[model samples]
Target: MNPAERLLEVGRYEEAERSVRESLAAYPSDAALLALLASILRARHDYPAALAAASAAVAANPRRSAGHVERAESLILLIRSREAVDAATTAVTLDPSWPGGHLVLARALVAARSLPAARDAARQGLSLAPRSVAVLLTVADVERAAGHREAALEAVQAALALDPGNAYGRWLLAMLDAERLRVRKSMRALREVARDRPAAPDIIAMTWPIRGVLSGLRRGLAVGAVAVCFLLAVGHWWWPQVDTFARYVSAVLAAVMIGFAARVLVPAGRLPWRCLRLLPRLMRSASVASLVLVIVAVGALIAFASSGWWVLAVVALGAVPVLWALGLVEMVGAGLDDPGMRPALLGLAGELREWWRTTKRELREAWTADGRRGE
Candidate 1:
């Protein structure tokens, strides 16, 4: 069992499958083996085969809750939520004291968008296994989807308290904070989680949004600069009032960029040299260039507001095009405003990367062993 588990853990699916087949040849009707094989098939993403394996396990021993749980898991993987709920319910009835059954039920309910039922099922599971991070996360997901944001926050906080090193827990906490408009706290929490798991699973892939925040803002500023260029050109001679308002708005924009850049370049409680050293090198040169452009833009805006000379700001706008061409201060990434497919792809990619690493390690070990001479 340990060998099979290790094989599965390290993505040696073919060997794991072979091991299971050899074992089943000796114990053809073993329900546990059938259930284990179902799980192995699931890991290999052979969902239909996994379903068949799980069904065989259930048929082999109707009294065993493990078979039912395995069946439920396979059904959920196939997106057969209703069937999964039935299978999970059977597991719960067969073994009313176990958390596995309720966890499956909760997961199926979440897929079905039956938030109330999922929350209840998760709570039932938590009552049985009070410290299960998976069950707790499910509860929090249900609460969040049901518009109980604060409850979701509380649940995740409890999960973090239980396992502070859980990357998913920290990511979820950070997302909840982000949702509530606590940007600084969310940024800090997200950064901490990202630092811990550079290739985070799809379940907590905040890297794109978090890492691209400054870039996105800069991109936005570039676009705003273009728009302001147009507005200044049109409003300079035709609309005195328009030019006056554009000046104040441009000044505000310059102030905002300068302020945010300062925050990023210089955080409090550090010596000036250390803070400068810690600043992201990617943006350092761009930040200096942008500050200079901002100063020029501010000066132009004031001149335009005072004497209808808004055309001067247009020269400052040329810097944006240069930066954009250099690929320095530009918008990039799907960002936090994504329509929501990136996280799944990232998760899949992360799993595949791990599988590749495990396979490499196993091959290396086997090659070294083959080179050893027998004593």
Candidate 2:
């Protein structure tokens, strides 16, 4: 591999881009350098630029499988699934022996929602280069898309075992664990990845509490609101004569709890504020709504207890469903947006299917055995 290739391999995308660009200045028609530039651009998440570079590379040499692979990857990132599949198929047709081409085809097939074909293509690449980390990662990705969590996990683990410090592999594992609700494990892995990649988008920083504290508080608040509403109903039914002084005391405690929850859960400081900028616009809006609703519910609890306003309690009760819905949206949106979380989400879906299948099979077998006994 050239110096530019080595830099790209190590995730020094900017340096690799500079190197390749310098080489391209001297050999502007160099298909290899153009493809290399495309890879660097893709790594940096500049899909448009990457696609342009890949196109240039293909124009320079249509027969070069590497150019076609880069083009396919760029198209996939752009969400042009059909075009990506076509580009990848061309690469594979040009060089059927190249594991890289097969892996690209697998990824394109995945983008096109052709899971079985994607799996076959990935397996073919793995067969060609069993020890290749890239090939293994492709297989893992295909399995994850297929909702085969165990297979995806095993493949990724193998890739990591071969190259323990592989950042992408580590990130993928973290996401895989997270999809299964292993929050602590996922957070630990994410922290390690963050340490290595400080300048990466604020997505990871935003993800910290979104996955942990926010989720916990969301569940806690939902349950707490329900319980409080139930107790209020019981009190109204059994002891209709509640003293004002006791109501005031309950209101004070509720206020304290709200203050404590805010102090602990709300992100503060310039860093957090800066990280907040990385969230999608809709997500930012949802987050604000969630925080506001949390405070509103607590405030309603205070008003209801202190002033004997039953309607305030009803308002708090009404907020629960909306709060829960917002939390669910945030969780699923984060999972879909984050590369690490996306696979985990897919894996979780697969696990759910497996669980239902197992339950159904056991039920059927039990029913059959019961029928035989009756006979």
Q: lDDT for each of the candidates? A: 0.69, 0.78
Over 107-166, each residue of candidate 1 has an lDDT whose tens digit, in order, gives: 888778888898899889889877888778877877887889998888898888888897
Model 2 misplacement above 4 A: 10-15, 205-282, 294-375
TM-score of each: 0.53, 0.63
lDDT per residue (tens digit) for residues 1-375 in model 2: 889999998888889999999999999999999999998998987777888999999999999999999999888877678899999999999999999999988998998999999999999999999999999988998999999999999999999999999878888887788667565666567668877778773364436544354555566656655666566666677755543443564476566665554553353323334555577665666676887887787788787776877677678778878977887787666545744344445556888999999999999999999999999
Q: Which ten residues in a row have the lowest lDDT in candidate 1?
A: 330-339
Model 2 whole-model lDDT (C-alpha atoms)? 0.78
